[model samples]
Target: MMTRRGVQWISSAADDPEECREHWALDPRSPHALPAGRYFDVVAVGQRVGLETFDQLQRHGMPLGPVMADRASEQVGFFLPTWAKSPFDRMVRQETADRAPEYRYLGENSVVVVPGPMPLAGDRYIWLRAPMRRPEASLPRIAALAAMFVAASSVVARADRYGREQSAASVDGGATHAH
Candidate 1:
């Protein structure tokens, strides 16, 4: 899923443990790019989910798996679980109590892992997790954004002075174009 500009994106930002999604977007070639619009993926941490939605996704054949510490999470040690419908689905244990760069917010009703190809009830699966910070490594991006805004502002000012008229329009002013 390479964008015309050649930026690559992950299939599920929710599944990405490191939250290095913005950097991955800079790669200039990724499957995450949409045909249009600048979109940033958001992950919901430990928030309650509706039973209906959960059941719907589950009935759709959602598979649960242990969270793998991605390259980003590897730096820490937190692992998250993902759902079959979306890889971003993950879970954080209560013991980890993330108090650093990020914390794995808990979600209700995580899948029970079976053992020996069939984990029965009353089974326990031990997982290792490292403390994490939400939106880690985002400082650099903020700096970059400041710089980009300044550059764009300067250009816009110059253009306005030259009478290059531009109209202010809302993003969704009754336009129904696809992203």
Candidate 2:
């Protein structure tokens, strides 16, 4: 028999960039300032699993980038099936495997944590897997996550610098040729 699940209704402190930034900073694992620009910050699903994590998040659809964490820390990251073939996938899977068995079970301990500001109203119930306790595990997974984010940041930084340099060069070249 399928067990009935309850929604936890997870809510972000703020949906806007400024508010997100503030809240992100408060998280032990989030960056003080996320990359400046629009990104996929929300995922819509008709039904969600308990305390959505990376694996659960992936069940919905593709997000803009890798699922980092609720905060700046790498303690919580989700894995996408599309990424199943990558080394990162292995890392995520291992982490998921090592988590408490409760997370994988859809018994009683399941609840969905939705954003508080979401316009969702009325009582809607669904089945969800029980969430695993945030285990006190080794830092290796966190280290792996840090490496992934650092590499991503490096790529973005290099791209931004290159773009700026190209823009300046184009402007200078155009001015000289105009004379």
Candidate 3:
């Protein structure tokens, strides 16, 4: 879907992965634009989604998927405050432990990949050009990472549900939307 911001986004339920790539590649407004086969580290959606909100999204039918090293678009990743010693962090750690042995991270709470397909495809190596030693520099990177995760999760959930609906419909004479 092309947003008002001029960003062309592909729903996880998109019919053609190749076509999505083609559209992304052709869009000059796309910051992560690349030719076929290449992928951006994250899909910028220009907003933030809280964890609770993400849960609500799932309740509404967008289910996040597991993360896979070989396929970034198969899962979503996130970043949290390393110093955020809360119950949320503990839950996050437990989930992180479930990730594949070759999981990626930044600092302790810096980067975390939740299980779900990201909108982009590539290895999960986040690099910030800003000076990490400066406290203020961490702000933008953190915000960007968080937004990427939320946006990606939205795509994954929608796509996953769409795929399932298509499959179910094909199997039977009609399809029922899962809420």
- The candidate that achieves the highest lDDT relative to the unseen native structure: 3
Decide which is better by TM-score, 2 or 3. Answer: 3
User: Candidates ranked by TM-score, best first?
Assistant: 3, 2, 1
- Local error of candidate 1 at residue 117 (angstroms): 35
Residues 29-90 of candidate 2: C-alpha lDDT, one tens digit per residue: 22222221122122211111213333433454423132222321112322222222244434
lDDT of 1 at 61: 46
Candidate 1 off by > 4 Å: 1-136, 164-179
* Candidate No. with top TM-score: 3
Superposition error at 17 for model 2 (Å): 26
Per-candidate TM equals 0.18, 0.28, 0.29
Error of 1 at 59 (Å): 42
Model 3 RMSD, rounded to 1 decimal: 14.8
The alpha-carbon lDDT assigned to residue 5 of candidate 2 equals 14
Model 1: number of backbone collisions: 26
How would you encode candidate 1's per-residue C-alpha lDDT over 1-179 as one tens digit per residue? 12222112222323342343453445412212111111232222111121222233335443221221122222211122221112222211111223211323222333211111122223232121111222232333323322322333344446665543222223346344445
Off by over 4 Å in 3: 1-136, 174-179
Residue-by-residue lDDT tens digits, candidate 3, 70-162: 132333233233432243334334434243112233343232222122233333422211111212224333433333344444655677799
